[model samples]
Target: MFGGVTIGEFARLTHLSVRTLRRYHESGLLAPATVDPDSGYRYYTADQIPTAQVIHQLRELDVPLADVAKILATEDAEERAGLAGEHLRRLEAELARTRAAVLSLRRLLRPHDDTLRVELRKIAARTVAGIEDVVAQDDVLSWYDEAMAELDAAIESRPLGPPGGRYANELFTDGRGTVLVYRPVADPPVRGRVHPVHLPPSELAVVVHPGPHDDIGVTYGRLGAWVVDHALAVDGPVHETYLVGPRDTPDPAAWRTEIGWPVFRLAVTDVMPGKNPGQTGNPPP
Candidate 1:
């Protein structure tokens, strides 16, 4: 007998409801100290207060019930520490996602009254020496890292400029795509996927995207719409030239990518002003 405090009295003392206490009993996490068989009532002792408080704190932190039971049952300090640490890491990741979303929302709320600048320019032919791969869209990031690492390993000298570029083509409409990575250099290796692919000189509608690659799609969409608004049409797949990719630049905000949509110049004004042909621009609010 926990100094003979009934379930109702224990709930009041612990700031927990009687229903919650019954649930704890059913889950066997915080069982009552005594049971009155004749009345089918549960009673808790004052001595059980510590255990009840621990359960309450864990629940407040949104710990899983099973995990709370495991923590309470485990006598080893190291195991409990590891469990808590793992949960903390998960919580931190969730916080990071929330923060990113909030920042994106703030950008969206700002005025878009000013017309986005779009210019047509001829890109000169350039030689880029780097590893290339036909990577699936889902595995593109890993493929990018691996290709860059391979280039780094085989190179006698690193590219004298920014990390370089990724050329993407719509191989599969839904989720699959092929992307090629190229770095500016005089000569590249002959083995593996490392072969010379000439980038033809073309007139491109260019927009500078300064931020993480995660949100470049938003910029792409906006630029595409701007091009359409000006009566232009993209005639080919888009190109992304990373002037400051992750390997070369650590800060995401410092990363600059020139998002280019190859276009055929047009003079028609009949195209709808608000229609977004390339939903790649600043992310949807």
Candidate 2:
């Protein structure tokens, strides 16, 4: 081996454990320059020190082993840099989410009035430009961003009202279902996935969920409890109005999402003998 160094000496030079170096060698991530077939000992050359250092830096960034292999296997400088750039972008997004979570936790730890204000309102039927799809739960966030972008690009004008979405219960309970996102617009131009459609009028038990959606589920639970207490629950999809959202402001505290649950007054006799009085007994999709 050129400028030969034993495995132990190489590990010391790289500031990595001998065991870790061995593991990396077995994974083909950082193989030594030479191996003694008789003694099963690994040897490294001084020239391989930079490679070891690069591998260590990548592992510190939590890049997957497979990705590390891909990066090392590519000899093109631009391709290697592109792979690292892509991973850095993912790390930035994860950091943003972590910061948002910390902010949400601070609010949850503080004491304040926990009361929820709900209103009963009739929403008139209206025509909208939108897109509908059966999206997997895991893909919802990215799908929503693309769908909204398409809608925004197609309209080329301000929407008449805040954007809204209809979520079928199966989307949550079964992990995959239909989702419709729309912007209220008059005579919107149909382009790409954007098309004109009419929404039905319905009475909704609505409540405002403030702050980042990280804890919006808590608001949903509170609203459901309020519906059951008021005997106004019904069978239908959930609706959401993004009054002030990520697109509106960077401050989580300024964000507002209106959660609407379908409801109708139930008579004493209308209550099923064995079923929940607040339930409409609509079958799940």
Pick by TM-score: which candidate is best?
A: 2
Candidate achieving the largest lDDT: 2
Candidate 2 Cα errors over 4 Å, as ranges: 1-13, 26-28, 32-47, 60-67, 77-113, 268-285
lDDT tens digits, residues 71-105, model 2?
Answer: 99999999999999999999998987787677667
lDDT of 1 by residue, 1-285 (tens): 335788989999989899988988999899887787788788888888888888888887788999999898988989987887777787876876677677667666788755555556688877666566566676776788888777666656566565555455563355565576776666765656566667778778888888786566567768877876667777766777777768666898888888888877665334544646444431221
**What is each predicted model's overall lDDT from 0 to 1?**
0.73, 0.84
Q: Provide the lDDT at 76 for model 1.
A: 90
| Model 1, C-alpha of 259: deviation from truth (Å) | 1.4
